[model samples]
Structures are given as C-alpha cells and as structure tokens.
Target: MSEKFQKCVEDFQCLNCGQEVSGNGFTDHCPNCLYSKHVDINPGDRANNCRGILKPINIAPKKSGYTIFYKCLSCDLEITNKTAEQDDITNFLITLKNQ
Candidate 1:
C-alpha cells in the first residue's frame, strides 16, 4: 500500500495569509485561494521547511524546464517544478510561444 494514500488528513497553516488549512486526504493548496506553501520536497513528504509562499506565475514546455513556472511569493525567488491541473493557462501560453 502507498503510504501517501493511506495517510490521514493533515492540517497546515497557510504561510501566505495565516489561514489554517485542512488537508482533505489529498489537498495540497489552500482552497480559499489556491495558494501553496513550499513545505515539502515532494507531495506529503513534509521534508522541507522553507515555509515560503509558492505562487503560480508562468509555465514552460515539458522537456525544457521540467514543468511550469513558480515564484516564491515571499522573496520573489523563481523556481520551476512539476505542473498541475491549474497550470492550463501557463501551458497554453508556452505552447503558443513555442510555435
């Protein structure tokens, strides 16, 4: 069995807005605003403690940058991690730009 899927709900305080968020077994963003904190190196790992605000900014193609564009809301730092469903807009723009 996968430990991640078997894990129970966990609550985390939104570092961006000080809002307490409940992880509904599979949640990774603040439902109130869709903002995510840089808390884990991987989903549900809880290994990272950067506590930085992860904001969705831009998106690049799949092979070049690995995924979408991510900017740290707190320090304005830029990073590119894997993309999610919410990355549609950025992906579309990147696709157009590439063509």
Candidate 2:
C-alpha cells in the first residue's frame, strides 16, 4: 500500500497545556508549549489510534532545520517533528540544552 502524504489542517486544543492551536496545514505541535497529540501515523494521515499526549522531550539540529523529539506519555512511543517556523525558539533551546 502506498502512504498518502496529505496535509490535514485542523485546529485543536493542546492536550498537555490546554492551548488553542491553529493548524496551518502543517502545524503539528503547539507553538506555545510545543506539545502534540499522537493522532497521525504518517505526516497528517491521522491513521494512528494511539491518541496519547506527545510530550516534548528534546530537540536536535537537522540539515533542513531543527527537529523536536516527542515521547508519548501514555504509550512510550517516540516521534519527531521538524521545527515549524512559528514554533517557540526559546522552548526549543531549552529542550536542546536539557538533552
């Protein structure tokens, strides 16, 4: 089966910080707290049933930009997302330092 790479633009409240986040077709994590919900198995496919709160654990420098690492608090699954333009750089730095 071929994976569909679709952009599922949807606004949702952050499960961790209760922040209202607006999705710009690619906005995955909350810009305020950098928290994301484990809703998609593929990039915006939303096929995953593990609806766990994705907690920001660390940040790593990527060639394109930076990637934020997340760990599912409920299921212990790890996920990574490339840093978004609207993401909080301050929080990203803090996460990088703590790593």
Q: Pick the candidate with the highest lDDT.
A: 2
lDDT of 1 by residue, 1-99 (tens): 533433346788766556687776555655443457665666666555476888756445675333545677766667555544432354345544676
User: TM-score per candidate, in order?
Assistant: 0.47, 0.80
lDDT of 1 at 13: 78
Task: Identify the candidate with maximal TM-score.
Answer: 2
* TM-score of decoy 2: 0.80
lDDT of 2 by residue, 29-90 (tens): 89977889888878778888787999888878888767888999879999888878877768
lDDT of 2: 0.81
For model 1, the superposed segments whose C-alpha errors exceed 4 Å read 1-8, 17-20, 58-69, 74-99
Residue 24 in candidate 1, Cα distance off native in Å: 1.8
Candidate 1: C-alpha RMSD after superposition: 8.3
